[model samples]
Target: MGEKQQRDRDLTRWGVSRRYSSLDMFYLFPIGEGLHTIEHKGRLFDLLIQNRGSDTTLVVFHGSLPPTQLTLPCLQGEGVSRLADVNLIALADPSLVMGDIDCAWFLGDRRIGPLRPILSPVIRYVLDSLNSKRTILFGGSGGGYAAVNFAQDFPGSIALAMNPRLNFNGTPSSKLPRYLEVCHGAMSRTPMLRVKRDFMTPNLLDDVNKQQDFDLLVVQNKNDKRYLHRQVNPFLSGVENPTRTWVSLFNGGDGHVPLPREEVAKLLKDLSNMESQTSDEYNSLGFESLGDYKQSVLSQDFS
Candidate 1:
């Protein structure tokens, strides 16, 4: 009969095992290290959180998945242990009305109006609950777009993206057009330019240039020619502040895919350690940048 009672009834109807007294209570509940669905503002977010009892939280956003499948990468095999002691949370993007869509860059679905506004608050709530002092956003491809986009909301956070697609509007062959038509209710007759600009920013560089406090680490595979020329190169060149961004170009892996997981792990660990120390301290300790760090790690990996 009451609002809380109605909400409880809905959760029970949806087959949720537990009942929460309130949304705040749900967000505050001690989360064990595993897959969880946090309901916020009438939307459900699937998050796989690996808690390591550390002050740092690494939120990994998944790239485009296969048709009709919703699998989170880095969840299998080595799992979150590759990041070591940092708390890792892997998030799955909500599908559009179509079931085959992989990711929408956390742009929200028909059910939930705009996603980032809702999703950002939900993540902030989670970070607060975890008492996270430092935050890192990681992802590849479309997920990379999400990592950089969301980093704008959390200033001073780290955004580690691998071969990220920065311009959705420019890449007409990408899933953006279809995503707009299905999720945002754009008609076939509607101009794509209007749809893209109306629903979300056409380019991520626009947002990246505006944020001053965050650090961006972009790892790109040189073989991904299309992305290298269109997305990565353009994005990097457009960056107003080179000091806040790091780029690592390598020849590992095939087109568009990220470098080997082991190499990525080494980079993450090295960056995590170095970031914990101030720049002056890091320079004093003889480290210039993550590019140098990547080279060092690569030399060791090959040898």
Candidate 2:
């Protein structure tokens, strides 16, 4: 049999049917100015390649349970429409129902078997081609965890995590049974449960502290029942440079509820426009207090 056919057969053994071939699932097409769809390793990624690009790149990671189809392109479209001009890239997790492994958090780590080999090269290629002076990685929840973990791979990058968990090995949250189901399904397919468990966000942050000069921004809703005190607070205390990190606490919204689109747009605009010679520049950007943040969203005063 041909190598490709043998590989297909092997994937079949793992419950992947031939109809779901990587080539069949992945495609690229332009959706708008500076927006395009890309598929890498049978997963979707969105790119917004703008002419007004700067030395910085904005990498957005989607939250858990993203729709499986046309994810990246949609994100790119929304990003370009709302945020100011800047290069943007977005990646979606493969597991459709669960947030686990959604951020490629297990990439380059001991868990998840050969999945990393399939993903890491693509990520490296994207990052290398950009040659960005700085990269800002941002995501909510599961994506946020990924941004924090992956920021170690890119020196001098900034990671903004919104209500992200530090790890996923513990008991599942009762309120999110669907997410738990997906996590269980994903874990059953990989050796993640048995592999060394030390490569989670907090531990990865330790490595980032030792080897990288990166900034971290964690935004948490004070009313977040799932992760506010449970994960976000622990992560804040564990990081090496607490002085360089910033935490924005908003008062309303459940942990899983998406942040307001306008607030996210404003954040992207601010990040794109700010000069980052030092941490002071990052700190100097005005972030509204929790009340103000909520009021602005209600009043439609993102400008």
All candidates: CA RMSD (Å): 8.1, 10.1
| TM-scores, all models, native as reference | 0.77, 0.63
Task: Provide backbone clash counts, one per model.
Answer: 0, 0
Predicted candidate 1 versus true structure: per-residue lDDT over 223-259, tens digit per residue: 8878877777666666666577666678866677777
lDDT of 2 by residue, 126-172 (tens): 55566656677887776676677677666677887777766554223
TM-score of 2: 0.63
> What overall lDDT goes with each candidate model?
0.65, 0.50
Task: Output the number of the TM-score-best candidate.
Answer: 1
